[model samples]
Target: MEFTAEIDIMPLDALLDPQGKAVSGSMKNLGLSEITNVRIGKHITLKVKAKDKSEAEAKVDEACKKLLANQIMEKYSFSLKELVA
Candidate 1:
Protein backbone atom coordinates (compact mmCIF):
# COMPACT_ATOMS: atom_id res chain seq x y z
CA MET A 1 0.00 0.00 0.00
CA GLU A 2 1.02 3.55 -0.66
CA PHE A 3 0.35 6.36 1.73
CA THR A 4 0.80 10.11 1.70
CA ALA A 5 1.73 12.03 4.78
CA GLU A 6 0.98 15.68 5.36
CA ILE A 7 2.96 17.05 8.25
CA ASP A 8 3.10 20.33 10.07
CA ILE A 9 5.98 21.43 12.25
CA MET A 10 5.73 24.45 14.51
CA PRO A 11 7.56 26.09 17.33
CA LEU A 12 6.19 25.35 20.75
CA ASP A 13 3.59 27.87 21.85
CA ALA A 14 5.49 28.54 25.06
CA LEU A 15 8.47 29.69 23.03
CA LEU A 16 8.82 33.02 21.28
CA ASP A 17 8.92 33.13 17.52
CA PRO A 18 11.13 35.96 16.33
CA GLN A 19 10.18 35.56 12.69
CA GLY A 20 6.51 35.55 13.55
CA LYS A 21 6.92 38.64 15.68
CA ALA A 22 8.79 40.42 12.91
CA VAL A 23 6.06 39.62 10.46
CA SER A 24 3.41 40.70 12.93
CA GLY A 25 5.14 44.05 13.33
CA SER A 26 5.35 44.45 9.58
CA MET A 27 1.65 43.88 9.28
CA LYS A 28 1.01 47.21 11.00
CA ASN A 29 3.42 48.96 8.67
CA LEU A 30 1.47 47.59 5.76
CA GLY A 31 -1.74 48.95 7.32
CA LEU A 32 -2.88 45.50 8.23
CA SER A 33 -2.93 46.01 11.94
CA GLU A 34 -5.76 43.59 12.22
CA ILE A 35 -3.34 40.81 11.53
CA THR A 36 -1.48 40.21 14.75
CA ASN A 37 0.32 37.41 16.50
CA VAL A 38 1.46 35.97 13.23
CA ARG A 39 3.00 32.53 13.43
CA ILE A 40 5.11 30.66 10.93
CA GLY A 41 5.42 26.92 10.56
CA LYS A 42 6.51 24.33 8.07
CA HIS A 43 4.42 21.91 6.07
CA ILE A 44 5.80 18.78 4.52
CA THR A 45 4.26 16.21 2.24
CA LEU A 46 5.73 12.84 1.33
CA LYS A 47 4.73 9.49 -0.06
CA VAL A 48 5.59 6.16 1.51
CA LYS A 49 5.16 2.51 0.71
CA ALA A 50 3.81 0.44 3.61
CA LYS A 51 2.12 -2.83 4.33
CA ASP A 52 -0.85 -1.14 5.93
CA LYS A 53 -2.20 2.13 7.31
CA SER A 54 -0.79 1.42 10.73
CA GLU A 55 2.64 0.83 9.25
CA ALA A 56 2.45 4.02 7.28
CA GLU A 57 1.48 5.98 10.39
CA ALA A 58 4.33 4.50 12.37
CA LYS A 59 6.82 5.33 9.65
CA VAL A 60 5.64 8.91 9.45
CA ASP A 61 5.81 9.30 13.21
CA GLU A 62 9.32 7.89 13.29
CA ALA A 63 10.43 10.18 10.50
CA CYS A 64 9.10 13.21 12.34
CA LYS A 65 10.71 12.24 15.64
CA LYS A 66 14.06 11.24 14.20
CA LEU A 67 14.63 13.70 11.38
CA LEU A 68 11.83 16.03 10.44
CA ALA A 69 11.04 17.84 13.68
CA ASN A 70 13.03 19.10 16.64
CA GLN A 71 11.16 17.65 19.57
CA ILE A 72 12.83 19.96 22.06
CA MET A 73 11.62 23.19 20.49
CA GLU A 74 9.12 22.19 17.88
CA LYS A 75 6.09 19.94 17.81
CA TYR A 76 4.74 18.00 14.88
CA SER A 77 1.42 16.58 13.68
CA PHE A 78 0.73 14.56 10.61
CA SER A 79 -2.20 13.11 8.71
CA LEU A 80 -1.92 10.08 6.51
CA LYS A 81 -4.04 8.98 3.61
CA GLU A 82 -3.82 5.99 1.38
CA LEU A 83 -2.89 6.72 -2.20
CA VAL A 84 -5.19 5.20 -4.77
CA ALA A 85 -4.13 4.76 -8.35
Candidate 2:
Protein backbone atom coordinates (compact mmCIF):
# COMPACT_ATOMS: atom_id res chain seq x y z
CA MET A 1 0.00 0.00 0.00
CA GLU A 2 1.03 3.59 -0.60
CA PHE A 3 0.53 6.27 2.00
CA THR A 4 1.23 9.94 2.38
CA ALA A 5 2.54 11.31 5.63
CA GLU A 6 2.66 14.80 7.05
CA ILE A 7 4.83 15.57 10.03
CA ASP A 8 4.86 18.72 12.10
CA ILE A 9 7.60 19.58 14.56
CA MET A 10 7.44 22.51 16.90
CA PRO A 11 8.82 23.79 20.12
CA LEU A 12 6.93 22.88 23.23
CA ASP A 13 4.59 25.43 24.75
CA ALA A 14 6.98 26.06 27.60
CA LEU A 15 9.87 26.66 25.21
CA LEU A 16 10.68 30.05 23.77
CA ASP A 17 10.39 30.46 19.99
CA PRO A 18 12.74 33.25 19.08
CA GLN A 19 11.82 33.21 15.41
CA GLY A 20 8.12 33.41 16.17
CA LYS A 21 8.73 36.19 18.65
CA ALA A 22 10.78 38.10 16.12
CA VAL A 23 8.11 37.74 13.51
CA SER A 24 5.47 38.91 15.97
CA GLY A 25 7.57 41.95 16.78
CA SER A 26 7.99 42.68 13.13
CA MET A 27 4.27 42.40 12.58
CA LYS A 28 3.65 44.93 15.32
CA ASN A 29 6.16 47.22 13.74
CA LEU A 30 4.37 46.87 10.42
CA GLY A 31 1.03 47.78 12.05
CA LEU A 32 -0.34 44.24 11.79
CA SER A 33 -0.55 43.98 15.53
CA GLU A 34 -3.89 42.26 15.51
CA ILE A 35 -2.15 38.96 14.86
CA THR A 36 -1.04 37.62 18.17
CA ASN A 37 0.28 34.36 19.49
CA VAL A 38 2.48 33.51 16.55
CA ARG A 39 4.26 30.21 16.50
CA ILE A 40 6.63 28.76 13.93
CA GLY A 41 7.04 25.11 13.07
CA LYS A 42 8.17 22.77 10.31
CA HIS A 43 6.09 20.68 7.96
CA ILE A 44 7.37 17.52 6.31
CA THR A 45 5.71 15.38 3.70
CA LEU A 46 6.69 11.93 2.52
CA LYS A 47 5.31 9.00 0.61
CA VAL A 48 5.85 5.52 1.92
CA LYS A 49 5.15 2.01 0.77
CA ALA A 50 4.04 -0.23 3.58
CA LYS A 51 2.20 -3.45 4.02
CA ASP A 52 -0.66 -1.77 5.82
CA LYS A 53 -1.84 1.41 7.48
CA SER A 54 -0.56 0.30 10.86
CA GLU A 55 2.89 -0.37 9.46
CA ALA A 56 2.96 2.95 7.70
CA GLU A 57 1.96 4.75 10.87
CA ALA A 58 4.69 2.99 12.80
CA LYS A 59 7.32 3.99 10.28
CA VAL A 60 6.16 7.60 10.36
CA ASP A 61 6.27 7.65 14.12
CA GLU A 62 9.78 6.31 14.13
CA ALA A 63 10.86 8.86 11.57
CA CYS A 64 9.40 11.65 13.65
CA LYS A 65 11.13 10.51 16.80
CA LYS A 66 14.45 9.77 15.17
CA LEU A 67 14.94 12.61 12.68
CA LEU A 68 11.93 14.86 12.29
CA ALA A 69 11.92 16.26 15.79
CA ASN A 70 14.07 16.92 18.79
CA GLN A 71 12.19 15.17 21.54
CA ILE A 72 13.96 17.10 24.28
CA MET A 73 12.73 20.53 23.23
CA GLU A 74 10.17 19.95 20.51
CA LYS A 75 6.98 17.97 20.21
CA TYR A 76 6.00 16.23 17.00
CA SER A 77 2.79 15.16 15.32
CA PHE A 78 1.99 13.33 12.14
CA SER A 79 -0.92 12.27 9.97
CA LEU A 80 -1.07 9.40 7.54
CA LYS A 81 -3.46 8.86 4.68
CA GLU A 82 -3.77 5.99 2.26
CA LEU A 83 -3.51 6.95 -1.36
CA VAL A 84 -6.11 5.78 -3.78
CA ALA A 85 -6.18 5.72 -7.51
Candidate 3:
Protein backbone atom coordinates (compact mmCIF):
# COMPACT_ATOMS: atom_id res chain seq x y z
CA MET A 1 0.00 0.00 0.00
CA GLU A 2 1.02 3.55 -0.63
CA PHE A 3 0.50 6.28 1.96
CA THR A 4 0.92 10.01 2.05
CA ALA A 5 2.39 11.64 5.11
CA GLU A 6 1.79 15.21 6.09
CA ILE A 7 4.27 16.39 8.65
CA ASP A 8 4.57 19.57 10.63
CA ILE A 9 7.79 20.49 12.37
CA MET A 10 8.02 23.41 14.74
CA PRO A 11 10.38 24.87 17.25
CA LEU A 12 9.67 24.05 20.83
CA ASP A 13 7.27 26.45 22.53
CA ALA A 14 9.91 27.15 25.15
CA LEU A 15 12.20 28.44 22.45
CA LEU A 16 11.89 31.81 20.78
CA ASP A 17 11.37 31.84 17.02
CA PRO A 18 13.26 34.78 15.60
CA GLN A 19 11.76 34.47 12.12
CA GLY A 20 8.26 34.32 13.50
CA LYS A 21 8.92 37.33 15.69
CA ALA A 22 10.27 39.28 12.74
CA VAL A 23 7.27 38.45 10.62
CA SER A 24 4.90 39.29 13.45
CA GLY A 25 6.56 42.65 13.86
CA SER A 26 6.18 43.31 10.14
CA MET A 27 2.47 42.56 10.33
CA LYS A 28 1.94 45.63 12.45
CA ASN A 29 3.77 47.78 9.93
CA LEU A 30 1.45 46.47 7.24
CA GLY A 31 -1.48 47.84 9.31
CA LEU A 32 -2.44 44.45 10.61
CA SER A 33 -2.08 44.99 14.29
CA GLU A 34 -4.57 42.30 15.13
CA ILE A 35 -2.15 39.64 14.00
CA THR A 36 0.23 38.71 16.76
CA ASN A 37 2.43 35.96 18.06
CA VAL A 38 2.91 34.50 14.63
CA ARG A 39 4.84 31.25 14.51
CA ILE A 40 6.81 29.83 11.62
CA GLY A 41 7.06 26.13 11.02
CA LYS A 42 7.74 23.65 8.27
CA HIS A 43 5.33 21.35 6.51
CA ILE A 44 6.64 18.30 4.72
CA THR A 45 4.79 15.93 2.43
CA LEU A 46 6.12 12.57 1.37
CA LYS A 47 4.99 9.23 0.03
CA VAL A 48 5.79 5.93 1.69
CA LYS A 49 5.29 2.36 0.60
CA ALA A 50 4.34 -0.03 3.34
CA LYS A 51 2.42 -3.18 3.93
CA ASP A 52 -0.22 -1.50 6.06
CA LYS A 53 -1.25 1.69 7.72
CA SER A 54 0.57 0.82 10.92
CA GLU A 55 3.79 0.18 9.06
CA ALA A 56 3.44 3.39 7.08
CA GLU A 57 2.91 5.35 10.26
CA ALA A 58 5.98 3.80 11.79
CA LYS A 59 8.08 4.69 8.78
CA VAL A 60 6.82 8.27 8.84
CA ASP A 61 7.60 8.54 12.52
CA GLU A 62 11.05 7.20 12.01
CA ALA A 63 11.75 9.58 9.19
CA CYS A 64 10.61 12.52 11.25
CA LYS A 65 12.74 11.56 14.23
CA LYS A 66 15.82 10.48 12.34
CA LEU A 67 15.97 12.95 9.47
CA LEU A 68 13.18 15.50 9.13
CA ALA A 69 13.23 17.09 12.58
CA ASN A 70 15.87 18.06 15.08
CA GLN A 71 14.51 16.43 18.17
CA ILE A 72 16.53 18.69 20.41
CA MET A 73 15.01 22.01 19.39
CA GLU A 74 12.07 21.04 17.20
CA LYS A 75 9.06 18.80 17.58
CA TYR A 76 7.13 17.02 14.86
CA SER A 77 3.75 15.46 14.19
CA PHE A 78 2.45 13.58 11.18
CA SER A 79 -0.74 12.15 9.78
CA LEU A 80 -0.93 9.34 7.25
CA LYS A 81 -3.60 8.70 4.66
CA GLU A 82 -3.92 5.84 2.24
CA LEU A 83 -3.64 6.98 -1.34
CA VAL A 84 -6.46 5.94 -3.58
CA ALA A 85 -6.06 5.22 -7.29
How many clashes in each structure? 0, 0, 0
Q: What's the lDDT for all of these models?
A: 0.96, 0.91, 0.95
The residue pairs found clashing in candidate 3 are none
**Can you list the residue pairs that collide in candidate 2?**
none
Q: Which pairs, if any, clash in model 1?
A: none
**Model 3 CA RMSD to the hidden true structure, in angstroms:** 0.7
Q: Which digits, one per residue and each the tens of the lDDT, describe model 1 over residues 1-85?
A: 9999999999999999999999999999999999998889999999999999999999999999999999999999999989998
Error of 1 at 40 (Å): 1.0
TM-score of 1: 0.94
* C-alpha lDDT (0 to 100) for residue 70 of candidate 1: 95
**TM-score of each model, in listed order:** 0.94, 0.91, 0.95
Looking at model 1, report the run of 10 residues with the lowest lDDT sum.
Answer: 32-41
After superposition of all CA atoms, the RMSD between model 1 and the true structure is 0.9
Give the candidates in order of TM-score, highest first. Answer: 3, 1, 2
Worst 10 residues of 3 by lDDT: 76-85
